[model samples]
Target: MSCLVSSTCSLVPFDSSLNRPSRSSKLGSSISWQSSFPRLSIEIGPVISSPIVKKESFVQAAWTRRSRGEAAKRPNKKSWKQRTDMYMRPFLLNVFFSRKFIHAKVMHRPTSKVISVATTNARDIRTNIPSLVDDEACRLIGKLIAERSKEADVYAVSYEPRKGERIEGKLGIVIDTIKEHGIIFVP
Candidate 1:
C-alpha cells in the first residue's frame, strides 16, 4: 500500500537594497513571484516541512531579558545539613564513610542527642568484620546500628547520607542490611 501527500508553499521575495518583503508589482498580490522551489510531495514514510512560521515579539524578548537578570541576582542555596537541622525531626541516622573506615550514628534529632553508634573503629565491629572499609563491613555496621536502635526502642530513622554521594555501592548495602534487620528508613 502507498499514500501521497503534497503541500503548497508561499515565498516572499526580498528587495536587495531594503532587505524586507517586496510586494508583487506584476500580480498585485502579497506573493512577489512563483518560487522556483518545487511544491513538497512525499510518499509513505518520509517527513514533511510545514509552511507556518514563528515571529519573535518585543514583549517576549523583554520578558526573557528581565528573567535572566533576576536569575543572575539570586542568592546561593543553603546546604542539606543546614536545612535538615533547621527542620528538626524525631530521629535521624547519619552514616559516614571514609577511605578506611565506616561510621554510623543514630540521633535524637530535635535535641541532637546521640542515641546509638556503630563504627569500624569500635572493638566489636572490628572483631566481627575483618575489613573496616568494604561493603561487607558497611553491612555489619548497619546490622549493629539496627541492633542498638532496637534496644533504644527507635524503629524508624531519617537516613542522612553523605553530601554529594548517591545511595549506591557501600551505602546501599548498609541500608539494605538495616532494613533486613527490621529497621525502617524514613527517606
Candidate 2:
C-alpha cells in the first residue's frame, strides 16, 4: 500500500581504533568501540522492502507481454480463423478476371488442392464464347465452374474478392449465375 518513501541508510566507515593489535589493546578496543564511530548513532530498523512487483518466470513474462500486446492490436482474420478447426474452411471459390480471360477456381483449403477450375480460355469455352471478358462469358464460366464444383462433391463454397473490389458489373453477374445454378455460397 506504500509508495517509494524510504530513508537513506549508510553503514559506518571503518576505523583503525576498532582493530585488535595486542592482547591488552584488544580489551581496550572493545570498550572504546562504542565511541569509535560517532556516525553509528544513526537509527537502524527494518526496511519497508522493495515496492517493485513480484518476479515472473520467462514463460510468465512472455504470457504477460503477449496479453498486453493482444489488447493493443486485435487478432486479424487469419489469426482469428486459426483458433477454429483448421479443416473448417473446406473449399474456397476464387474468381480472377484478367484482360483476356476469366478464371474460376474451387480449391480445397485444408489440403491446398484445386478441386475444380473453369476458364474462358478453355477449348470448349473459347470456341463457343464470342467475347471471353464479357458478362455473358462470365456467366457461362460461373455455370461451368458450378457444375464442376458439384462433380467434386462440394455443395457449398466460400469466396473473397480481391482487395478494394466492388461487387458489380460482370463480376456480379458471374456470382449470380453461380448461385442460380444451385451452388450455394458460404459467406
Candidate 3:
C-alpha cells in the first residue's frame, strides 16, 4: 500500500473468514479480538519490453498546425495592452511614484514622443512643496501634467494601472486631480 504514514504494508489476499464474527464464541463473556476487514490482493505486472513513446501534447499539435503568420505574432506577456493599446489609445497617461517624489507624464503613443511631464523634483515644484511624496504633491503633479498635455492639444488620454494594483490613495488622488483639471480618461 502506498500511503503517507508508511509504505511497509503489503497487500494480502482476501480472507473469507474475516468477513463476519465467529458464531461459536459470540457471547459477551467469551470474547476474542479479531480483525473483520477482508484483505485485498494486489497484482503487479511485468515491466514493459518496449521503451515508452512520447505522445504529442495538445499545445504542441496546435502549434504545429498554426499558420506562419500566426506564429510570427507577438508571444510576450501583455502584448494586447502594450501593442494594441498603443495604437488604440493615442495618448497615454503614466504616473510613477518614488520614495521622495511623484512623476507624472503624458505620451503620444503613435510617435512614441513624451508630450508633457511634471515631477516633484522640478526646481519650481521642489522649492515650494513641503512633502514631495504626499497626496498634495501627487495632486500638484497631476494637475500640472494635465494642463501641459492640454497645451499640447491632448484632451483625452488613457491610464493603465499596474496589473493587480489598486488605483486608490495617492494614485487615486493624482488621477482624480487630473480629471478635475479637465482631462478625459478613456476606458
Candidate 4:
C-alpha cells in the first residue's frame, strides 16, 4: 500500500538586509525564494508573546521621561552648612567675648548686665536661666557683636548668678581685696 499527502505551501522571500540566512533543500531544483529561507520549525509550544500591548506601561515610560526633563531644568540646591557658612564667614571674627563687649559698647550699653548667663546642650537659649529667650534676641546679640570688634572669644559657662547672690558680700570683699592688691579699674 502506498500513501501520498498533497499540501499547498506558500513561500515568502527573506530580505538579506535584515540579516536572514538562506537555506537550500536536499533536492537540487529551481531555487525557489520560499524554500531558500529556513523554516522556523517551532515545536507545539506555549504562546510566549501577548497579543494585547500594555497601555499603562507606556504611561509610566512617559512619566519617567517627564521627570528626567524636569530634573535637568532645575538648579542644584546648597546644603544647610554651605548656605550658613556663606553668610557666616564674614561675621565669624566678631563672635568673641571682647568683641561682644565692644559691640555692646557701640550699642551704648557697655556695661550690659550679664543677664543670667548659662550653658545648655540645646542650640537655642544657652543661658542658665530657664526663661525662654527668643531667636530674635540671640540673633540681635550676634549681629551687635559682629558689627563691633573681632577680638576676645567669648564662651558660655554655666553661670549660677542666683547661687552667686548667696556669696555676693564675699564676692564684694574679694573684689575689694583684689582692688587693694593694685587691681586698678582702668575704665
Q: Best lDDT goes to which candidate?
A: 3
Q: Provide the overall lDDT of each model, using Cα atoms, as 2-decimal numbers.
A: 0.71, 0.72, 0.74, 0.32
Q: Give the alpha carbon lDDT tens digit for every residue of 1-187 in model 2.
A: 1122235222333334543222344556355544432332232345455433222212233432346467668655345466553367678888888999999899988888998999998998799878999988988988988999899888888877788998899888988998999988876
- Which runs in model 3 stand beyond 4 Å of their true positions? 1-83
Writing each residue's lDDT as its tens digit, candidate 3 over 1-187 gives 2222222222432234564322433445543342323333222324434332233212234433546676578445354467687788899888988898888889988898999999999999899979999878988988898899989999999998889988999999999999999999998
For candidate 1, the TM-score is 0.52
TM-score winner between 2 and 4, please give it.
Answer: 2
RMSD of 1: 15.9
* Higher-scoring candidate on lDDT, 1 or 2: 2
TM-score of each: 0.52, 0.58, 0.58, 0.14
Q: What's the distance in Å from true for residue 142, model 3?
A: 1.2
Query: How far in Å is the alpha carbon of 181 misplaced in model 4?
Result: 38
What overall lDDT, based on C-alpha atoms, would model 2 receive against the true structure? 0.72
Candidate 4 residue 102 Cα shift, in angstroms, is: 11
Please give the lDDT score at residue 132 for candidate 1: 89
Off by over 4 Å in 1: 1-88
